[model samples]
Target: MSGIEDLLREDLRGKTPYGAPQLDVPVQLNTNENAFAIPEDVAAVVAEFVGRELRGLNRYPDRDAVALREDLAAYLGHGLTADHVWAANGSNEILQQLLQAFGGPGRTVLGFMPSYSMHPLLARGTATAFVDAGREDDYTLGPDFVRAAITEHDPDLVFLVSPNNPTGTALDREVVEAAYGAARGLVVIDEAYAEFARDPGSTALGLLEGRRRLVVTRTLSKAFAFAGARVGYLAADPELVEKLLLVRLPYHLSSITQAAARGALACAARLQSEVDELKHQRDRIVKNMRAKGLPVADSDANFVLVGGLRDAAAVWRAILDEGVLIRDVGLPGRLRITAGSEEETAALLDAFDTVLERRPALFDLQEQAK
Candidate 1:
């Protein structure tokens, strides 16, 4: 082993970093990024804001990012104030900070499986124990299952991903409440895809009113089309915000990032207008895939989880060969696809059509659903 390799932290040895394949394909849907770009007017404003902030490049950004926090709090209006919101590079960093504050050696973190893949990685990165729990066969979480698991494991932190990744299904508000009630420590509702939800009001933010241990995290990456800005924030009790501060480094957010996020927030209306079209495409994909007898999970986000392939990896490769790419998340016979533009979605569906036409045995969803 190399000298540095031997000196690495024991827990870090032989660990692969978390990342999806960033292939340069015509249609890239592996990662759950917003398929659209920022609106032209919003881009112009963001450019101006960043340009103005460049003069202050010599100085560190607002260490607490107070102004940005205020903007974020205003953006996520569940009666959240600046003190109730915390911002960081992305939701990954936000979760890591939470783990740093509430999780460490000897502490356990639990999440429902086939959800966001990063939850356990963040927990382990913080030196916290990681535990995986399964969802129902339909890839939905039951409140009773959540409570029973929480009661059994008694983890220091719990993650309930609304509009869960891979599965593309949202949790019931009752499930979130059950998880919170069962946990003695912190309960985090990762709502990174909240904006794309079928019902915008169906959020855990309402459950946070009187609950001190509950936290609802959201990101500007998806609906705001600000993934490049790397802005993620959470609304929690003011006390939890205070705790995250202890573990976060000084000036964690750059001046450019702060200005960019605030600029995006200022143009929220223009950004949200694109959501309706995206949802239309999302629903279209679901309906069409179901008509083909595929076990397509009902999606509240801008993606769909499809099952019934005999060889998911093979299908993934065949689709890529057609100049389209989706994700084969190692779930047997399943793939996750992010909703894309009309043309891109058509390309994806066409790719699948070609595969199924020639290889009907491989695309049998009815039998696979069993």
Candidate 2:
């Protein structure tokens, strides 16, 4: 610990955001972002909208984020209005607001492991307790397990992720219903990959509308291909939405972001088609990898998890040199590959094959060690 940093928050010691890897690799497949570029029309709309605001840089943005909220609520199709929405730099910050509103010392936030890495980190930021719901070997949560955890910990916040990252599995509907029955806590389902899933329309809102304790988080980074834009949304009961709005910084969503998100929403047909294309490619990737004797997780989103690769980091390093990049899950012997355009996907698999074929000695070592 640096003795000179005495003014820092006591909890800040030895903690930092999850460090994403940076590589100069050619084909980047690491972050689960959409590889497609934003539609030309959508980009033009954002440019024109922000062009109007270029001279207003000195002025503060709408503190309430009124326009973006209204558009988002309507896009969600849940009888929402501006009062029923809130905007932040991304859903990540929106989560921070939820924690602030509902968390404090001794209060606990609960979630499963190998899910999003941010859940526990954010809970710690609130000075609240954190708990985990254990999953079976396959990463599926049973209704019994959920009920057991709720009965045991009784957390104040429960984070859920559908079509989870790194694993790419979706929670079964029955399991979701049972989860709602199990907890009195605020249940937050992160559907950041929802748009790329089979039925992106099945948001948790429809199941528990008017319930002030339930919240749904979505991001435009994936489907809209605007990850750099940092625009995401929250769908909750109007009362909860109002609370988040009150806590958020003013004009968190820039004019460009608003225009870009709205433009993408208007071109839903094109976006949906892109999502469909990604899904098809993802299926083929999973199938081919599985047939190659590589263990892959069943996925409903735009990515696939290929397991059984010994030394995920070593494999990742090799892929980088092969002119491809994939996410290092840090889980022993596991790697996550994002679904890109058909050509991109092919390039990734070719690179994967090259690495695995030349790597019999690594796999032999792993088996011996095990």
Question: What is the TM-score of each predicted model, taking all chains together?
Answer: 0.97, 0.91
lDDT of all the models against the reference?
A: 0.89, 0.77
Model 2 earns a TM-score of 0.91
Q: Pick the candidate with the highest TM-score.
A: 1
Best by lDDT: 1
**lDDT of model 1 at residue 158?**
93
Residues 141-191, candidate 1, lDDT per residue (tens digit)?
A: 899999999999999999889888878788888899899889999999999
* Prediction 1 global C-alpha lDDT: 0.89
User: How many clashing pairs does model 2 include?
Assistant: 1
